[model samples]
Target: MPSPLPADLTPTELVELMQRLTLEEQAELDHLLTAGLPRWLPQVGPQTDALESEADIVFYGGQAGGGKSDLLLGAALTRHEHSIIFRRESVQLVGLEERVARILGSRSGYNGQAKVWRLPGATPRILEFGSVKEPNDWMKYQGRAHDLKGFDEITHFLETQFRTLIGWMRTDNPSVRQRVICAGNPPTDAEGEWVIRYWAPWLDPQHPNPAQPGELRWFVTDEEGGDREVPGPEPVMVGGELMTPKSRTFIRSSVDDNLFLQLTGYKATLQALPEPLRSQMLRGNFMAGRSDPVWQLIPTDWVKAAMTRWSPRQEKGPMTALGLDPSRGGADKTSAARRHGAWFDVLVTAPGQVTCDGPTAAGFVAPLVRNGACICVDSIGIGSSALDFIKGLNLLVLAVAGSEASTGSTVAGNLRFRNKRAEMYWRLREALDPAAEPPIALPPDQELLGDLCAVRYKVAQLGKAAAIQIRDKDEIRELLGRSPDKGDSVALTFVSGIPMPGPARQRTAREVPDWRVC
Candidate 1:
């Protein structure tokens, strides 16, 4: 039995009351009002929650068969006046087109060539279906205005493409709500990993301050393209201007949330797929396909464990070294890391736009360089300029060039490196090993974690000797879609002969002190 509706309510009062109703209550009201008409409505659970979400950006799907595509179509059909749904390829829109045709009962309003559906109503809503496959394909919709933007299987598109498309999302109609809805499962490869960072509050386990599912968080982008989270959704002063932060939230969806899918035996089909795809699709496990590649120099687990041990209030020794990676200009960032014994402080970074020259980068690094702290600069390309300026100031500085010959080898002397870069990176890897002395602690910075774990290495035989060869920086930048500035700064702190402070362990006669490894 259900409660009777209040009698003689005004239209405005009824609308306000409907707005305050829970999803289930709203559904009951819809059932009573329409008298079971053949109108489309959101299926209960994730679909209803997604349709009702007020977030500026909402990530709506995780597991397979979660009614992700249906939710996008349903929202466009009912709520939006002008909307666009995107897929990685135009061919992928076939199923969605068929669904739209069935829902509309005819293709009379659809323009096949333009891929736009014009629904006749009081407002005459428009829905567009499109694809962005190539790098510059997103430019096709440069100045287009859309109130509702949908990206299905969002991880298939590059982060740059997704961000660029969202820039054009706008509408002047007050009654038309604006929102970005993205749907996807866990990334199947490294190229898709940026999605995890974009939704860090909900997806990233290593995020310093994790957010609960569907919790609204506000973020504003700084000049250097880094996002800074503010306390609330209110406007804040940034660079002498009032900037409003956008609200974002992620809602996890699963097969169980879709009653129709559950009854259709789709879960069994997902279970039969090969791992780690099975885990990704069945349980929506984000870590499923993230197994360490064979050539990955630093394991993800090792970096995560080191981050877990880090604390801002932990006791620290004197600053042993400061690593500086300068960005001359362009999109790269100038980053610095301060090392205290085995503990590393959070990375400090400025965009290339601000730190454009050597003097500017030096200004940022000067405060961190104290007495007895060796300022280690990459000294390659623009970094050479910063190194020269630091040396002129009469401060102790170490110039590190990746192309230089390795000055040291492993404790066993069996592992030789092809270049100084290989040796320095390997030293950091050894320090992060489970049994390494003076356990390393790293700040929980998601960007730094990604950079460190992105590197790949190989053992090459150089005639009579085998030398470890690290993949070139250019190659790494291509893979990561940005410079590995943070990782480079951290690795530079391990320049040879720099002593780090840590707990001393009594050693047997056969044991050699492990201090040199750090």
Candidate 2:
């Protein structure tokens, strides 16, 4: 009698056993097992490229109707041993779930309550669908591990939530592969702009070093938690420790890439949309929706022009001023900007975990403050603590309180501001104006650019006249999804005229003046 087949034979074990069988027997057994298996494979173009990409992180979609959702689902089903795909909300999973049911020919392996599909085999594969709706909702999956993680419509989620959930991507199974795949269209709003910065080498027109589509680049986090791109994929020494950089790439796909979508008349639908939306959806233009808001305090084009004029080799005057925006313990960061005449240096930031207290914040500022540089510090809330420490050291410091009354007007002298913050920000705006003498040169920094462009202004009635009032910090935070630390620091640079520090003078608590435009 023939030996009985093993009940717990894994796919790998079965493949090994098949090698010992006769050619006819092997063919017969292969036909018996796979004859009626439901088929789902990646489509021919960008979808296949995405599936074959060996990048640690891959961003796959640019335009709508590109079969992005199906790409995520098919990758999980066909290749991964354990996978989870996320949408911003649970309701978005309905269509995906239905498609999954059709592919399997039945819902027998699906556990709707747990939102997982357990494929039957000796080593069962697991596919899960989840949502992270709120900012803190990512904590729900804190410790759960998966070999492959997918984010659909990634721009709809906060960057923090995306980073936190991807921290759990891991696998112990030797047969499984590890990767993160994100699919989304270009961001439609200011809040989603982080995605552009995250993939700047591919998306940002002003990126110093641009990369072609599907080109691989490597990046590692610096000591301050900011990403720094390296030369190649090799491990490098950082902060005295060896670290390996993660490889990332972007693959652009549009409606044209999906023949099925093209035949369904999706191209015309995208073209019928409004101005910016139509351009964004049809051409996959990352630069769409970049027009400044009507009340935007600063124009986007002005900032871009300033960045273009800036070069590391440009001659700069002595460091004249320093601006500090300190943060209390939490997700916030303590940021500083140093100004030399019309040129500003790249921002320096320390996470709240490192610079939470007064002394710690002071420590970060002290070494950066030169002998003649006038230091401007935000004196509201936790910033006041840092200001106190700096003042104690006998440094020339200007304590900035945004809520205080404005002591200055626009450079043209015709416009008035509601408060010091408005006045300070307006000064930077005036300096950046194309017609202004001594044009400002700003370092190419994406977060600083976003912060400067995100704020809006309105005319507020002040007794007999109208004054320009900027929106509250809390409101801007809601729109940008984080505090405008970099913007605040840059604005603070203009709190007072660049003073020529004559001599070291003994100072009292009251000697530290409130923000006053010299």
Candidate 3:
């Protein structure tokens, strides 16, 4: 529900209303009152902008130790006269309550039972501390109303909970501007994927479609499609009358932006995290995780840095290759990944030609292979047909029989990979390693990143030799509710015999032989 503030209300009225606001509200309103401005540090200037603007929702977060918690608290304080701040666990509020108490000092009266600190008056100003630990806890707030609502460590809550609470951000006082503010650290798993998706365009510093800091974008909820965002508030006919679009703004700030934290060793601590975690926490990367805990591959930071250096050029010496993973079921995806130098970001998937066998599919594949786009196909299920068909054509294609024995990269001792699939995937990891030059860049693909993260490898003994066996896509699909088709497609690109970068003249796709269709 929107605040009761009239569109035509004068600026003077808004100021007069804020003057009598509770201490919490005063903290934030002070800037507005003093100079009709939102005071802020350069580090958190955008945060202030979002809070002061008419934007209904604002997400101020990114890298850890960005003073996100403090900002959230301050924002809550500014609106505390009619405010409610949330923490995931009710217990977490105790520490925050202490901070609130120190700020309120002797001017406030607490009522723990009511979860509120009150400044008694004919029109009393109050600030409340609360929690919504579990999704169901939201039910307790069904009838509550407040102009200001906040969520700290928002990634810890469920999407449904956040949605439900938004419905409660209503107030009779237009002077008490209604705002939803949230803060959190970088997410670590697929569970955080929802938050990432909601804020992706702004969260990704490299996003092609950048949402400027403090700019608002609107989204509408649909019964069929859920919530879909719009570039700006689109006018909607509500009972023959136009309605304003509700908007959201996400402000991204890293530890480096917060001078206080940067002055401490916190930034160094975040940098010390391993691989993807370091990137996720330090860079405030939303797409960093989305992998299963047990199966994460290709450190996220390594991938992020490599993406900056990704050049879609075939190396001068090695041949660029395409990996194909045709869908098994008729409607399943047939994903294809293009390996340019050592990168796996270029991926494409197409459906398999049903009833085709390895020997016959080779006829169609020969033309593509002859054209210099070397092919690597998954030889499992219907793919075996394409594999056999292409092999008979005498084309330079890798028909990967995943279950086949591992043949490359001998172990330090008796350790070995379980099958060809393991060897291929392990090599893909090595290719993504930062030490490998001409860095690999993946497509800005959330699905592919998730797939890569979902692949879990386990070591088991086979006849006195230890071998690593990667989890199958079927297993991964259970975790992600979809096949890792894109991931497998890239993995296929690494099959032995595929061309790799070397010292030679660079070859463009145009240089290959013309395709001879089957």
Candidate 4:
């Protein structure tokens, strides 16, 4: 329950008082009263709900750069006397200490000798910062009482360490509240795996759980202590009275949810990571059934290097072409990219308009089409309408059907490419490969690079023949936060080996765009 209003003040008076307060004063009041401090990002605001709720266990985590650390720091910055923070080492706490100092007006009231903060107007608040480096370290707080305790990364310590701390979290003063805060990224080790198990109902899909990203859930139990999802059937008959259940919740976060981190290009670094690690760190693909060792279509490093390849910034092909992957609503992204031939380097990549109706998308790209640029449109899902819309513009167009792309079976230099989409993806790799004469360039987009790198392929047997099957958009969307629309938009550029959109200029040059039919 939220904090009650002051006994002497009515709702109207409280509203009037709130109206008179400035934004900074309101923020500080919110922080001091309800643990509602905010970080540089808004998604983390839900975490404050998790912190303030009356829960037996609360965990916040999932992906990196979610401002979890700063949250823990802010939660610990209260005037309580018995608040403590735990990390793997004391040096690890220094950064948080500096952050708290800046947040608390740069006042260094912490007395290192006593392990307490000596704010002038308040009682001497004991803030213990301890290290749980080994199993024996859990005993350090055996005799102490902590009203508030926070774990920087719970998985870094043994399960025993966490359980021991639970006992120490108690308060004798009626007005003082007891709370626990823990923050971490996805666990990468056995200890982390243990945490997932300990909180299986909250983290695992095997159980029927009712927790949302920030919502708290209450649970009761019988004598055996097994968690009860719903209570009040018999109320556990605790001492002939209705017993209340404790609450617990988990709040998930990712780099995308943190706007500040996104601005710093942290996502590109996560995307550049290698396979299973990349899936775990970037996509938060925890305990999933499988992650193919690779995209099977292209390597991540190759695309990353393509993003870094030195190329003239202002080069324009004799003719330009547009790649459009249309989406309607909800989770889909209407990605569109423009590239110049014959090198076929991407120049710009962006999302199309709202609703992404065929006509709307057609209108967005009509000017480019009128500039004599051919367009390769994904004629799948909402894209079919988009294709017709663009075609209705009386503009040059190449349609990439999800069904299949090639007229004859063999394509792209005698390779039995599965379908048009596969053929285009493979040819895109060929175009970007450094070994290929006249290496191509691509837009320096992190998401575009990540999606391109994530494409995978597999060979299938059809009795007497072998064929390649590319990973589909739905499968790709599961790993990527959204559909790989941008990547596919670029892939569409290779739909057909049409001549570079200008008068013939390079039949004799090795570095010129290849004018061959795939």
TM-score on alpha carbons, each prediction:
0.79, 0.81, 0.50, 0.44
Tens digits of per-residue lDDT, candidate 3, 1-518, equal 53777877643455456555687876765555446432323233555564566778889887787777667666665544677888878888887777766655553587887888775655566778778765468888887988888888888776657877888778887676788888887777754655766676677656667787777778765322235565577776543456566888787767765544544558789989997888778887776754456546555555556556655554433337877776544324566676656555455443343323443344334433323566788878878766655544444566788888875653344457788888888777777777766546777666666667667787788777778788876676655545677888878877677654233234344433222211
State model 2's lDDT: 0.83
Name the runs in model 3 displaced over 4 angstroms.
1-58, 62-182, 188-201, 208-210, 217-248, 252-296, 313-320, 327-334, 340-345, 349-374, 379-405, 410-414, 435-447, 474-482, 497-518
Expressed as tens digits, the lDDT of each residue in 30-136 for candidate 1 is 77866766457777677788789889999987899988998899889999999999998999999899999987778879998999999997778999998987766
Over all chains combined, what TM-score does candidate 1 have?
Answer: 0.79
Global CA lDDT computed for model 4 = 0.63
Candidate 3 vs candidate 4: the lDDT winner is 3
lDDT of 3 at 397: 60
Per-residue lDDT tens digits of candidate 4, residues 132-246?
6755576777868888788887767655477667667788887887777787765653224546655666676544554566556665643322245654233445435576666
Candidate 4, which segments miss by more than 4 Å at Cα? 1-292, 310-312, 342-355, 405-415, 497-518
TM-score for predicted model 4 compared with the true structure? 0.44
* Candidate ordering by TM-score (highest first): 2, 1, 3, 4
The candidates, ranked best first by lDDT, are: 2, 1, 3, 4
Alpha-carbon shift of residue 398 in model 3 (angstroms) = 5.1
Number of clashing pairs, model 2? 0
lDDT of every predicted structure (CA atoms): 0.82, 0.83, 0.66, 0.63
